[model samples]
Target: MTNTALTALREPAFPDAVITEAIRWTEQNGPLDDAQALRLAASRTADAHEGITQRALLLGERIGLQPELARARQWAPWVLLGLAALIVIAGLGLAGNVVGGGERHINVIVALASLLGLHALTLLMWLLGLLLPLGSVNTASLGWIWLSLTARVAGGKRGQAPVLVRAATGLLSRAKLLPWAFGLVSHGIWSLSFTVVLAAMLFALAFRSYTLSWETTILDPEFFVRAVQALGWAPAKLGFPVPDAATVMAATPATPGAAGQRTWALWLTGCIAVYGLLPRLLLVLLSAAVLRSRRKALQPEWQEPYYRKLAARFTALAPASIVDADPGRLRGAMPASLPASQLHDTLFVIGFELPPDMPWPPAGLPAEFAAHAQRIDGSAPARRALLDQLAQARPRTVMVVCHAVSSPDRGTERFLREVLMHCGECRLWLAGAPDAGATQRWLDWLRDTGLERITASDRPDIAP
Candidate 1:
């Protein structure tokens, strides 16, 4: 199957490519250590935002997400099939009850009511629900119920299945596809049931002898005649027989002539077909067509702030050989320092060219700094973006985290100097423990860059 269709069939919440990309992103950004993130970044698309959606399908299988999803896939179809079977059986029972199995006189009006009354009511309710917001129509549809049951059956209280299902539901709801998606299933069920009813009615009428009559104590004979004629008008236009005025006036609790009985049979079946089966069938086709046409729009919102940050991180994790320019090519006039009072009360922490081995955000840092923390590849674009943002915000404190094991370079000094100009106070964090001599060399290098106030520390507990 095509990957998009497979995702819709299996995951529902996200496409396969998106699900894998998200898993890769989580492994890298969260506490989980994933060496694959960097390796995958090397082969990623040139466009950072677009590249995040590229497939990493095996990641789920590698991380045990596939087994859980497989269980859900296995159970959903059977559950839906069982529900459909029950509906079909109910339709047969309804048809049998209406016809009285040729043992008693059939009340034509009562038969129509028994067969189509509940169907009409539910159909009207579904139509009315369409007037509300998107996704509100038929929230309790058999399809949604099947989804919930499948999630529970496969995922229970703790598994990736339910999580993925919920995500799919939320995504579909946001994309305004839930009503139509579920509507397809709901309408399909009703359509199938009505089809069964019509078939069973035709079968029973063919072999059995039953009288068709209408009896009412309070209403006049003309009322019954008008009702039968009015109800059968559309059916008659479709070539189904409708009784003449004399036939209607003569209907009693006794079997009529063979021709008259044939007319009644055609009228009853035609009315059911026109009113009950046809509407549900048309709705099924409409919902299916809508879902087919709009399926392409069923993608994750990559523009959201959370995904944006992940995109930036994906770019940052790219290898230096791919993104960085030669040190001699770096160009920009030194910026003037902003006043301390202009800075906001924000703690901005950035990892500057830290090696892949170092755990990001420096484990001991306070939780409040989470939002402001970022890691960059020290590429020109990354520098410009960071500088532009800092220029506007001018955070109160800026902390540049570096790998203590690596020696400082002129490019590092130049970037630090430019960054220092935008913040009120700056601190240097050497993320790993190196020898005292190496630490001294970094500290001395900071002084030579005309940054004496910036002290290098190995710990993350330093006050902002």
Candidate 2:
């Protein structure tokens, strides 16, 4: 693969133009069958957009849509983090208030439940999801909303973009890359927010003191005891202390000692830290790993029906005749020596579709060169008639004139090839001032056609 094609698959910029260029190349290089060309073209445009080179409109790098998407969403991460921080701060405030003053007993049930119960419930649900598939449960998740939100605001809907960009924009359910990126970012914020919540909880505990006890209007002591015991089981295994059966039985709407309060606080915070903050942090890392793996797997697939049809259509064109002086290779082709014009009977100068504004037998034509040269249109019909004429006129040296400004297309390439076959001696002459971009395209066509040299004299006014 050329660097440009690899880039086309990688960056994903303006791809339509690149496909057009690849198609054109396949048309001219007939040895490369349509399927091969189409596969190359499809692979390049499958996921990325390609940019055009400024001067020659040649294929350039694949512009990455993700970077552009990120740039568009630059403020999103900080904004999401800010919102998460505020929510965590608010949750800490609500969870921190010790509901005891006169008796110095923080309602033990509320105190632990406020800090750890929701997180434990969430962890239980997560475990349940793993153990048993819950069909059609509409769990509330901020991740989904945030991922789609990033897609919408990131120009994921740019006009006529490839499947990947469309997926990033959420037009397809199977967008592989964009969602991963959003997931990585969103999970990171969730992890950070949970960490801050844990920090706030610990900070509050440091400055304040409250005793722990539980009060129940309906439930028996056994029910509360079993609930606390079950919630503490996992943390207990990791060495956190659980209140004893005696403490549970004696627990009432009354204050306890500072040591008791500290134990209860540590047990609650330990559960939240282990089951909530830590698990969310792990999810953040997992999402990041998934995103990285997906990035490595990013590649263009060419097996679709759409690409197959294009390949068939392109291969259907009849190929033109070509000659092979077959040079050693692309680099530094050795130009063959053109014998002097005086050695030929007739020096025919053929004008190949020169623009009306540009005069024929353009100025700066050497007196020795122009005197023996005669002009003729370089079109197919004109060449066909000229072939019969040439069969009889039998010009010894036919110098075909083409502007250095115009890119070499099939018509001109075939004309020169046919003329070279029929004439005793022939050479392609590029007429006009040299421009690097046009000259390069022209020379590439010449090399492909097995014709490698251009004459010295050129008329400089034409542009293609």
Candidate 3:
């Protein structure tokens, strides 16, 4: 079994998208055929839910559902990496345009806006998308694009690849993990872009000399001074120099002194670090933390009608092996029926379908009878195992104990008839405080099956 199958059967830690895709594949493919279904059912574990999950996974593996899902998963990270590379290139281009070109004149205000303006807008939009309850946020992300590209690259029309992609997005959206997941990728790319921008700016400043001054026709000089001081305050606190009023007033289209230019260059890089890169980096961490915390809740909807129906089918398949055709009576000669008045020396008592709360080998039974009794839950494997034991022992008399609360059915009748083939005489005992009608119902069922010699009672003693 693959890690996915193991995790799915053990807990909901299985990938939600894959779980949904696996289920979708099952839905599209229909139930497993009887032979395969019964084979899985026969090996059911103690936990019924786990048993069903195990069977579903086995069925998927047999029909090639799992391999298709695995193939799609293999291409996801590569698609994401390709998308990240594109974002990095776009970032470098934007920063190069702002700081590049061998020009003697560089506008300080224009440089800052060009570097950080779009980042601020997109960041605000991401925040708004998160606060609002809408699906729009999902599409506005690199993660969504990555998912689409992965599906397309893996052949979306082939097998269950498209279903896998849709399931992944749908589950993430419903679980509220979409925003954080998208934000994580988005902020990470933005951070990378800003890093590239800052690096380019620092490199250009170190290698090339340019005059740094603000240019405006409508805005007053005082406005520019306040703006430079205000923008520089946070960066200045962190040791980036802020140009004072004298430096700000001395501006022109011509190149400035080396000292003035140094102050302006540090100020530009500092603003980008504080306003652009730092916020995005922090958001990247925040998104990662949120996604990590909420990951467990991203499970398949087990209570959905489709899954519930599958659960019923799987449960039925679990104990279905018992319904097989009865092994013919005693190989050759039929056993002679012992009279009701006769008490055999060798007795075997079998408890079948008894309630969990019911006492085994009832309290008043003789020690000899109690010693020979064994209780079994109605599983096909258990029933077959017990039959094998009885065939070997070949006890002269066999009494099958049952809970009176359970109505007699064809399954019960077939199993009882098979038991009669192994022993000379067979008896039935419905143990519980059943009403008169319930007892009479069993009596009718017993007679109808042609096992009329076997009498049933609530009593524990075997006095016939």
Number of the predicted model whose lDDT against the real structure is largest: 1
Give the per-residue lDDT of model 2 (tens digit) for 91-192. 656554643245445676676667656656644544443344342111223444443444455545661133223433231122244333433444455566
Q: In candidate 3, list every pair of residues with a backbone clash.
A: none
Per-model TM values vs. the true structure: 0.63, 0.47, 0.62
Candidate 3 lDDT tens digits, 70-140: 66567766666677788778878876776675675678888788777878887877777788876666676
Q: Candidate 2, which ten residues in sequence have the lowest lDDT sum?
A: 48-57
For each candidate in the order shown, give its overall lDDT on alpha carbons. Answer: 0.69, 0.50, 0.68
Output the better candidate (2/3) by lDDT.
3
Error of 1 at 322 (Å): 8.3
Query: Candidate 2 local accuracy as lDDT?
Result: 0.50
TM-score of candidate 3 against the unseen true structure:
0.62
| Model 3 misplaced stretches (Cα beyond 4 Å) | 1-12, 25-44, 62-65, 156-159, 254-259, 319-464
In model 1, which regions exceed 4 Å deviation?
Answer: 1-59, 129-131, 134-136, 252-259, 320-464
Worst 10 residues of 3 by lDDT: 1-10
